[model samples]
Target: MQKKVPQIVFDSKKPENSGIEILTIESLASRKTEIIDHNPEKAHQVAFHMIVFYTQGESKQLVDFVWHPVKKNTIIHLSKGQINAFQFTKKLKGYILLFTETYLKNQINNSPKNEYLRLFNTHLFSPSIQVPQDSNIIRYFDLFYEEYNNHTEDLNQQNTYKSIYSIIFSKLEGLKQFQPFHLKQSKQVNIFLDFKALLELHFKASRNADFYAEKLNITYKHLNTVCKATVSITAKQFIDQFIVLEAKRLLINSDIKSTELAYSLGFEESTNFVKYFKKHTGFTPNNFKKNYL
Candidate 1:
């Protein structure tokens, strides 16, 4: 039987009034435990953006079946539709801020959309960052939480939250700037971004680099150049990496059969899927599943 991944929505206190919810680590853990206990196979695919600030204690979380360690001063940002499971200790202390894409889209200006994309949308980078506990990042989160709780229908109050949100992204941008191989805007960067967006849309049905290049209205050579310059990988490699990652996620988190998953992933034969998975990951799909389990 193919087990289904559960879709989780933000359980806001006033669902009709706001699309945001703020809860502490303890609260989130309790609620998450209850849900998982009721349905052990419920692998959550959240439909909203989540920003988690870990202020104390150590914990682990499975994001898309990858285990990430959480510690004091660790901040993890998860975009919509990513699967996550909480595995934190009782001593964990922090905040989990949840907000819908619609709310963020309506609030954030167009100027910072690229930065937003780099931070939130890009799967090439790790979604979590470790920073100083007393840094301005935590301060901005504190301000956002305070403003979120005090939210009103007043335009000024709403703008206040938007302003704080912008500041938070600014802080994230600053942190990213200091990291090695940070994203920079350029013609190649723009092309690569567009290619990534298109790949996400068409990867299942079409994995050809030329197909993506045509969609981007550029030559395959140009697309490859852009991808190599932006991320030090060929365009074909990028596509394969994305597909293999998705395959791993499914293999570990669901009970989808190999033949069915192969067809679903556009492979004409299960043997071809096995060969492709092994070529990229050095392990066949079944081996990878066994290792993961």
Candidate 2:
């Protein structure tokens, strides 16, 4: 018997109200038992964006099967569709803001849509940022928290909240510019970004670099050159990394049988999938499952 991964949908029953919610880490920790009483060990696939700021205390969370440490003044963003589970201490203190895609599109109208896509879309790096407990960054979050809890439903209030939200991300983007691995703007970088988008859409059906190159209207050699220049990895390596990542996500988050998992990942034969997994990870499927699960 195979168990399915739990998919959590945002509460969309009230469209008139803003599609956003905010809570403090302390508040969430108090209700931890009530929240996880149903399935304590299951990782939830959230259907909304989660922005977490850790102002104090230390904890850890599993995002897409990778456990990230949460320290003071740290910010973590979890885009929609990522599997996550929390392990926080009782002293945790911070804010957790959950917003739906609708809220982003409707409320944050001042920023371009591509900016949102670039920030929220976690492909090349972990969607977490570390910052000194500077007053400027803290001020933006404080304003957002106050606005979120004000309980005002008027248009003017909504716009005010949206403005504060935009400022938070704007500052974060500025910090990202100084990151050592930040992708620079160039023709090669653009091609790599396009390749990643296409891979996300077609990885389940096609893992060939040539297919992606055709979709990008670029030659396979050019795609490989761009990938090597941008990330120091070849184009085919990028495809395999995406496939293996999804494989691990499924293996840890669900109870699907090995054969079914393999087939779902576009493998025609289960043995081939096992071999592929072993070649990349140096562990058989069963061994990997035993180690992680």
| Tens-digit lDDT string for candidate 1 (12-92) | 665354566666787666676476423323346778998888988998777777778989987788888787777768799
* Candidate 1: stretches off by over 4 Å: 1-4, 30-32, 36-43, 109-111, 132-134, 150-160, 217-219, 250-256, 282-293
User: For candidate 1, what is the TM-score?
Assistant: 0.82
Name the lDDT value of residue 214 in candidate 2: 95
Which runs in model 2 stand beyond 4 Å of their true positions? Answer: 1-5, 12-16, 36-42, 107-109, 152-155
Q: What is candidate 2's lDDT per residue for 177-238, written digit by digit as tens?
A: 65567764678767788899888888878989999999999899999999888878999998
C-alpha lDDT score of every prediction, in listed order: 0.77, 0.77
Which stretch of 10 consecutive residues in model 2 shows the poorest summed lDDT? 35-44
